[model samples]
Target: MNDRLTAAQASRSTAVKATLDYPVIDTDVHVNDYTPALEEYVQQYGGGELVDALRKVLGSRFNTRSNGKDWYQQTLAERRYNRTLRSPWWARVTRNTLDLATYTLPALLAERLAEQGADYSVLFPNDVLAPLGAGRHRQALHRAINHYHADQYSKYSDRLTPVAGIPLHTPEEGIEELEFAVKTLGLKVINIAGGVKRPIPSVADKYPAADHPEVAKYAHYTDFYGIDSEYDYDPFWAKVVELGVPVTTHYGSQGWTGRHSISNYMYNHIGHFADGSQAFAKALFFGGVTRRFPGLRVALLEGGADWGAHVFTHLLDRWDKRNREAVHNYNPANADLELLENLFQRYGKDLIKDRTLDKSTLLLDSLGVSALPHSRDPNEDEIDDFALAGIESPEDIKTRWVDSFYFGSESDDRTVASAFNAKLNPLNAKINAIWSSDIGHWDVPDLTEPLAESWDLVEQGVITAADFKALVFDNPYRFYTEANPQFFKGTAIEQKLSSSHTK
Candidate 1:
């Protein structure tokens, strides 16, 4: 035999060296959305009109800006630019389109996983998520894409688990899709968009008037922070808890309105996932969804764990100061009008002569007596404020914010170590940092890089081996298995998990 070893052999050797007692489960791996049979599924689900709509909606020139592009007569260069932008850098670097086989081929992907020493991976769709939108065709679109995703991983279910995409524009639709995907499709994990679009004037009022000026073709999508959301969405959360599938959001703020600078993709990409996940987590916590659905688990995918740590501390900081009781201190009613008047008269005799300081205008317009705090009880209105939902102590924040949510961190992220830092997190508690390799995407050049990069934390003394184990394996295991204890029942690591539990 030759003394030389293949690249796969070398990667396998490296993975063996870094092996942990627990199996590594990557929570956010992506799969290619463009299958040869995608259109077939679309047609089968009565999404022929949606296919026509998609064909009519011309693709964006910039990969960063996808919404509201002219649907007709797009230039060839624009299409070429978008396609080039979306392709992986490795393919460009190697100048070989076949490098994509690592993602496209199930055998190759499994080999790569074995080389990385990862026991399992949860697959997400990149392009499919964008098209799974709301409206008349939502159910059909959701069904088709979910069916395709299930088919993609059907044979590879031993090592790969595809997350079922469920739309949340309506609770009834969301519930129906969840049930169908889990029961009929036999999908174990479910993924949903962290945010929703608030159709202005509600879907009911807008539908009656098709030609109305207010009725735009696209609904004004907003962050679901619950501060301004039109829907309660408690029923959806209840369904998630009822079904035993841990909910994950691969949603990000990539091609949205604010991030729509046509110049640079990096400008739109930085911290986009973090922003989306933070908004969703905050909405769930402040809206009292977590309090109501205590058993519910949410994993914010592709965002680093640092956001989780920051958002948790930030919420407490805001809650400590922004409560109705604390805000009452700043009530305009508390301002002494008489004292201010005396000071104004003493300090501004020249201004009075010039008619600069108008007392009536100042009181009526600037600090109106009619809008005083005494006019309405703060306690009575406190119930209306979603942020003040029975939030008495740190326990509430810890339970609702910390325990209920898990952060999906890519292996290549340096900030992954921060999730394990007790000092950075609140109450010396750790945020659940689930390992998400994102192997098929541009961020990871090599399929094996994610696991190797994550081990850098251990080599740098950023985290202990035990901490790294939790980051890669324990946290992911807990996130999924806690929702459905039989999550790994037939998987490769069921024995190891069982042994650990027995011990």
Candidate 2:
């Protein structure tokens, strides 16, 4: 064994004794891309043209290229950013995670995980996230990436479950890939981009006018979430329910407006994932996607649990302030015309002569007004308000939001404690904050330290043993099984379960 691996294992032994014997299921482990195999899959799947297009748009190399010339790859400024004062000290302190073998070899990863005190991990692909930038060939490229993952990582099924990448540029394309990835590939987990492309013709003007006018007719930028979305993704959400596999997103909002500056990498990196997760989640809730398909569950990956708490509280707050009866305060139809006329007479100098209020031709009084907020008369049987699903109480909002969403959090985030604190959430509810061991990433230098870092919360009295158990094991198990009851069927987790089925 390598010196680092031995040290990692030794450290894990000390950490595991802190918590009760609960099987850890890390929902956000990542795997390095096997480029040659991915390329082969593209060729076999008749996606050679798509690959060539990707090479032209992005640099040809699959893994991150350190040329210092390519803008998309780490530029000199970004490299310097990683090396300079605060970033450099942080990097040096964190252990080396770039070693290819540590991530590429499944057996090594399994051994490393065991030494880290984790019983199981779900592997996600890094390079596959690139296809979201492509317009024409995204679906084909995602298919190749998914097939490659299934082909490469199936052997590690005992300890690692690989996630299938599915692009959501189009609902039809998403459904097709969903079926292929789940039924055909036998892959269990699904990862979709945080946003989707606007359907053709409607969002045409968002594209650059000069380049490929045909492509320009379609939206080049991705829609942040489904709220007020031009294209309805209800079909895709329904299809996911039918397929019985949960969807997750590790997408980020860096390189976009607020995070676009190149001078500081930290400026772009910090909270980028949370920004994306928040927008996507809020959109899903306000758009009524959760209401339409009650069984649809999504986990936003690697973005900490604190944001989930914030979103849940804010959704309930909005529902309270903007529900049908409450919204009448803002409705023009409910305005007291007589009181407004009296105020205008008392306060108006220039408007009284210019706009004469003839009781015979009073414009405000003459305007058509619905007694109900959204065209439904209050006297009728049903009220058609802005909130379509008729969220009667705050508990309804809490139930819908909490049930439909799960937040995947890194072990080290200080804010993760908010997820466990009922006082911090709406309706005194607990948000689903599943543990994400981000083992292969730079944030966790030593793979074995994640469990130790997470236990710090319990040590500090921020959360309880029950909260830690749910965060590390129960929540993730429930999310995966909510989609597929057989998710832990033959895995080590199944054997550890006191009951045959997941609770």
Relative to the true structure, candidate 2 reaches a TM of 0.80
True lDDT of residue 75, candidate 2: 52
Model 1: per-residue lDDT, tens digit, 1-503? 22222564667325643556677888887766554577677777775686654333314312222233331233446644542223111211122233366566666676667665588888886655555543567677778778888886788787998888887776777889999999999998888888776656675375644565244434556747344567667777787788898998866776566664444567767888898888788877777778888888999988889889888887777767766566656655567777777787898677567766665555554455666537565554663343544677766888888888999888768887778888877789888998888877777666656787888878888787888888888899999888988888888778667786898
TM-score of each: 0.80, 0.80
Candidate RMSDs in order: 5.5, 6.4
All models: lDDT? Answer: 0.71, 0.73
lDDT of 1: 0.71
Worst lDDT 10-window in candidate 2:
84-93
> What clash count goes with each model?
1, 2
The 10 consecutive residues of candidate 1 with the worst lDDT sum are: 87-96
